[model samples]
Target: MPQVKGSKQYHMVVVPHRPVRRALIIVLLLVAAGAAVAASYYWGYHQGMTQQADAVAERDRLREEVSVLTRESEELRQQVANLRLGSEVDQQASDEMRKEVIKLEEQIAALEEDITFYRGLMAPGDNNTGLTIGALNVIGTDIPREYEYKLVVQQLATDHQVLSGYLNFNVVGRRGEQTETIPLHELSSQVDNEDIRLRFRYFQNIEGRLTLPEGFEPERIELMAQSTGSDRKTVEKKFGWLVQEL
Candidate 1:
């Protein structure tokens, strides 16, 4: 250590070597580099935390939306189930209505059959036999000429029974003379029974041609139908002749 005589100051201040100066500068630079690394580490950590928070919030929002969608799906499922149940109920009701209609139709048919049976019972004389005569028409315009007649008879009862009857035709001439009785049996051989029973009706469709004698003009014709039974009854019909020249 050199000092100046009679002075408090040192004689010469020693300068630092280049290596030491470099070492100091390296230390300062290392400290500054350490501070910069710390600051960068803190900034990066903060940024990472912020990003994590945003991701968590997004996840929660997505979960809430999923829950809402699940609830809506459940509601739609319930509605679909209700609709299916309603359809089944409607189908069952339709089936019941069809059954009721069929039952009503059967009842109506049964009633109609019963009414027909009762009507047959209330009728007179064997209850099932009936005779109907259509309109009688003369063949020609001349009097006492050949004539054609159509008759329709029906059996009201279901039983298959035959009926036998007789027809008598009386003719009156224009000159106040009466002809003999004309028997239907002489013209037809279809008589097999005397009394007509239940389900037995006689249908006499007689298409006959009769010749009149010369100089005898028929003024009126009388038809008598007689039925053989315990209580015999006869039906008579009279027809007037239209005069025409031959």
Candidate 2:
């Protein structure tokens, strides 16, 4: 082998694919970051939607509960109103009853008063007996010449009837002259003479006519009556006679 120029060893410059690798790596990292961001955004949106739904459901539930409570409150209020109305009606009825009771009591009291008055009226032994003398007339000088007298006798006892007895009347003149004793039965011929019996609590009227004496003038008259009872009760009366000229 002839000695040729020394063969030089060729060292080729080898450039590595660093840029492509770096670019690929950067692209991958960017994709991964983008995916991660997208995933995070989606998760956040879903969480928001879920929270919204939950809030809506909670609001709906709250609204339902409020409606139920409102209905129950209305029912309770209605019940209270009804009870109050019932109470008022009962009070009104009680007031009416009280008024009626008062009216009835008044009526009963009035009736009782009327009954008492009637009872008093129906009581016995009411003394309603008296006597009366008619006007006396004179002939000329207004002096009494003739006189008419009426005597009324009433039985005081309402239990039994009384038989008529003799009625004695004495007329004392101004001159102290006395009249005669007259029988009551002989004075009235119209009456039944069979012992004039008067019913219980009845009045009997007896009339008599008398002529005065010519010399004496009558001024006053006195009357006395005696009942034919077992005790013989007597009644006396005095009256002034009016003397008028006829």
Candidate 3:
């Protein structure tokens, strides 16, 4: 052989061709099935966790609402109790006020009695006949259209024998267009047989009631006394119409 610029070497090889694509496809299908099972398991676990979190949050929210409602109920109860206490206190105060009023009225009545006693001791009567009308109190009773009067008579000189006397009570008033005189015996139902007589040496108290007629109005009163001794003594007094009733 002539010298060639390049020498060529040849080697013989044998390869067997079979259907390996179907086997590869079967392997790929098994791998894909395993991956799908793992992904499904992960998704189910995540969904369960999310549902549990939502349930816990709802439970907490309901508990908070229950706590707030409980607090409000307690507050309402406290307010009601305070109102009841305040009402009790107010009632007690009102009762105390009523008691004070009653006590004050009693005190005022006692003061008035004391004033009358002192006045009788201080200023003597104007009658120079050794006899005096000390006090005249007109009081009202519980009976309707009825009045009571008190006359206190005092003797300055005990020198006389018990100054025996009787009182003549006369009421001077106006009727229609004319002047009228009313007698004490006519206005009272208890004036009979020496009932208006006084026989005390120092003093005498005369109390009696006077009931008016249907429409008779009284204005002034004249109280006259007649005493018998060696010389008959007479005294007259005038009093304004003053009476009280309950």
Candidate 4:
């Protein structure tokens, strides 16, 4: 060591070797990027949950609409069935009414016929008091060309005496463009005798069954009655051939 006279004093200070401020800035940027990514993920999850809820609601609404339509269709079917049944019942009722009306008409016609017959028996419209023809009727039978005939004779006198007579009848018709007349005895299957005798006080009904020949179209009937005993008289009558089928 060397000795110096009158020397000045010196101070010592330390400086940092690493860059700490730049490292702090880099760490702050990394934290900001991570926050942005977390925010985006949360938003997407919320949107997906809301869309699922909306789809579920739409499905329920569609199911309700389908159920309503099904109920309406069932009601319409029931109404149609009821209408058809009512129509059938109405048709049956109408048919029955028509049948009843027809039956009533037939009964009325029969009653009218009976009234006419009784009136004729009570009053005869002829001047001859000895013997007279009241009515004549022809009825058709089931057998072909066969018919039943009825002749009614009445007495117009008030004495009510017994009358005896014999009747002769003939059927006048056309056969193949030729005039033909058939006697009652020849045409009648039930009456074999030529003389039809009658004995009655007020009225007498002579009935017989007859059959016509083939191709014989009858037009009229002629009858002649002759009284026997004290009241000797002769009566002639003509009647048109009209057959009532039974």
Winner by lDDT: 4
lDDT of candidate 4 at residue 100, scale 0 to 100: 55
| Per-residue error (Å), model 1, residue 133 | 4.5
> Lowest summed lDDT over 10 consecutive residues: which window, candidate 2?
129-138
Instruction: Sort the predicted structures by lDDT, highest score first.
Output: 4, 3, 1, 2
Scored by TM-score, the top model is 4
Q: Give model 1 RMSD, 1 decimal.
A: 49.0
Model 2 stretches with alpha carbons more than 4 Å out: 1-144, 176-201, 243-246
Clashes of 2: 0
lDDT of 3: 0.67
TM-score of each: 0.32, 0.33, 0.47, 0.53
Instruction: Put the candidates in TM-score order, highest first.
Output: 4, 3, 2, 1
Per-residue lDDT of 134-167 in model 4, one digit per residue for the tens? Answer: 7799999999999999888866553445689888
Q: Give the clashing residue pairs of candidate 4, or none.
A: none
- lDDT by residue (7-64, candidate 2, tens digit) is 7666799887688899999999999999999999999999888867765664465446
**Candidate 2, RMSD to the unseen true structure:** 55.0
Residue 18 alpha-carbon offset, candidate 3, angstroms:
99
Q: lDDT values of the candidates?
A: 0.52, 0.51, 0.67, 0.75
Residue lDDT tens for model 3, 1-246: 565669886679996765698789999999999999999999999998886776566446544655565555455455545655765788765665556555655554554454444333333355544556666777878876588978887665413235677778777887776778888788877776433687865467887888876566778888877776765677788989887644
> Deviation in angstroms for 95 in model 3?
12
TM-score of 2: 0.33
Q: How displaced is residue 155 in candidate 1, in Å? A: 6.6
lDDT of 2 at 230: 62
